[model samples]
Target: MAVKVKKIERKKMPFLERIYIFYIIAGMARTFRHFIRNLLNTKNIEFLEYPEQKPEDITPRYRGLHRLTKYESGELKCVACDMCATACPAKCIYIEACEVEGSKEKAPKVFNIDLLECVFCGLCVEACPKDAIRMDSGIFTKVEGKREDFISDINELSSRKRGDF
Candidate 1:
C-alpha cells in the first residue's frame, strides 16, 4: 500500500504586518496612553523612598544573615565538629577546632565564612547538630570596600542578635 502525504500551507502576513515598525509603533502608542493615564491619576503613582524607609514587613521564611547561637552559660554552642563546614556546598565555611582548656569538648578557634563564596543554601545551618548556626537574624548584608570584609569571623557571627524585621 502507498501512503499519500499532504503539503502544509502557511498564511503569509500583509506587507505592513511583515515590517514590524507598525506593530512597534502601535505598542508604543498603547504604552504612552497608559503612561499618560497613570501620570494623570495620583493614586496610580506607586513610588517608595528606599534607604530612608524600609519595608515594614519581611517574609518570615526569608533567610538573611547567619548567626551562631550561644549556650545558657554564655559559651558558644558550636562544638566545632566541622559538620557545617563539611555540609557547605560552596565550601565557603572554614573552621579551626581547638581543645577547650578544661572541657572535653572541642571549640572553634577560628571560624570564618566568605559571603562572596556562599550560595546561602542554608545547608550549613541544617547540618549543625547543636543548633549553633542560624540564618534568621534578619540583618541585611552590607557592601564592603575590601574582599576581606566579606569574610565574617566567629565573633561577628556569634554576636548577631535576632533583629526585628
Candidate 2:
C-alpha cells in the first residue's frame, strides 16, 4: 500500500510571542497574584510545629515503621520462617535462621530490613504467621544520615517503642 504524505503549513509567530516576554510576564503575574492571595489569606493556612506538635489526622490504619513484637516471656515471636522475606516484593528483608537453644524451633540470628528499599506495603506483617512483625509502631520513618543507618536489624526492630519517632 502506498502511503500519502500530507504536510501542514504553520503560521509564523509574531516578534512579541517569539521572544516570550509576554509569557514570562504572564507567569510572573500569576505567581505574584497567588503569592498576594496566600499572603493576605494567611488565616486559611495551617502550620504545625513539627516534632513538637504531631498532626492529629494520622489514621489508625497508617503504616509507619516496621517493628518486631515480643512474647510475654520476653522472647521474640518470630520463628524465622522467612515468609516475610519471601513475600517482600522489594526483596529488602533479610533473615538468617538459627536453631533455638533447647527447642526444635528456629529463630532469626540476623533479621534485617533495609528501609531505603522497603515499599512499606505491610505484606511482611500479613505474611508473618506468628504475628511477630508489625508496622503499627506509629513511629514515622525519617530518612536521614548514612546508608547504614537506614537498615533496621533485629535489636533495633525489637526495641522500637510506640512513641519513638
Candidate 3:
C-alpha cells in the first residue's frame, strides 16, 4: 500500500509562554495556599508520614482489600458464584470453590486476594450478587514480609465491628 505524508510545522512560543517561571510561581502559590489551609484545618493534609500517627479511616464506601463472608448461620456466603472473580479486570482474585453441605450451589472454600496484583478497583464487590465479598474494610494494608504474607484471612480483614464493615 502507498501512503501520503504531510509536512509537520512547529510554532515558536512568545516571551511569556516560553518563560515558564510564571507557571512555576503560580504552582508555588497554590502549593503554599494548600499547605496553609491544611496547617489550619487538619483534615486537608494530604501527606502521611506513616507509622508516626494512627492511619485515618477510609470511608465505608472506600474499598481497600477483598474479603469473604459468612451467613448469620455460619454458612459460607459466597455460593461459589464467581461473580467477583469474573468481574475482576485485574484477574487478581483466586477462588477455589467447593460445595457446602446440603447445598446445590458451590462456595469458595479457599479464596485468596493477591495484594501484589490487585488494582483495588472495587469492581469485585459491585459485581457480587450476594453481598459476600466487600472492600469496605477501612484497614489500610500493614507491612507483610512477602506477597503471600499480605494474604489475610477474613477475620483479619474484618477486624472492625459490623458497623465498620
Candidate 4:
C-alpha cells in the first residue's frame, strides 16, 4: 500500500490587494467618518476624568491584592500548611513555618510573596484550606521604584482587615 500526500497551495492576491492601498484608504475613511461624527456630536465622547473621579464600584470578584485572614481571637487563620506556596505556579510565594506558641497548629514565621513574579492566577487563594488567604482587598498593586518593594511580607498581608476594601 502507498500513501498519497496532497500539497496545499494558497491563492495569490491581486496586485491592488497586495499593495493594500484600497484597504488603507477604506480604513482611513472609516476613521475620518468617526472623527467627523464625534466632532459634530461631542455627546458621543466616552471617557472618565480620572484622578478627580474614580469608577463607582469595584466588583466583589475582582482579584486585586493578596491578604491573609485572621480568626476572631486575633490569631492568623493560616495553619502554615504551605499549600498555597506549594500550589503557586510562579514560585513567588515563600513561607517559613514554625509551631505556634500555645497552639499545636503551625504558623508562618516568614511569609512573603513577590508580586513582580506573580501572574495573579488566584491559585494560592484556592489552595488555602483554612480560608487564610484571599485576593479581595480591592487594592491594586502599585508601581514600585525598587524590586524589593514588591515582596509583601507576612505583617503586611496579615495586617489587612475585613471591610478594608
Clash number for each model: 0, 0, 0, 0
The sequence of per-residue lDDT tens digits that candidate 4 reaches over residues 33-138 is 9999999999979887753465567667778779999888988898889999899999999999999777788999999999999998999999999999999876
Residue pairs with backbone overlap in model 4: none
Highest lDDT scorer: 2
TM-score of 2: 0.77
Number of clashing residue pairs, candidate 3: 0
- Residues 21-62, model 2: lDDT tens digits: 998999999999989999999998879987678879888778
- Over 48-103, each residue of candidate 3 has an lDDT whose tens digit, in order, gives 68646645565667665565666778665777688888999988777787876786
Q: By summed lDDT, which 10 consecutive residues of candidate 3 come out lowest? A: 156-165
- Regions of candidate 2 where Cα sits further than 4 Å from its true position: 1-32, 163-165
Give per-model TM-scores. Answer: 0.72, 0.77, 0.65, 0.77
Candidate 1 or 2, higher lDDT? 2
Candidates in descending TM-score order: 2, 4, 1, 3
> What value does the lDDT take at residue 71 in candidate 4?
85
CA RMSD of all predictions:
4.9, 4.0, 5.3, 3.0
Alpha-carbon shift of residue 69 in model 4 (angstroms):
0.8
Error of 3 at 20 (Å): 11
Error of 3 at 95 (Å): 1.0
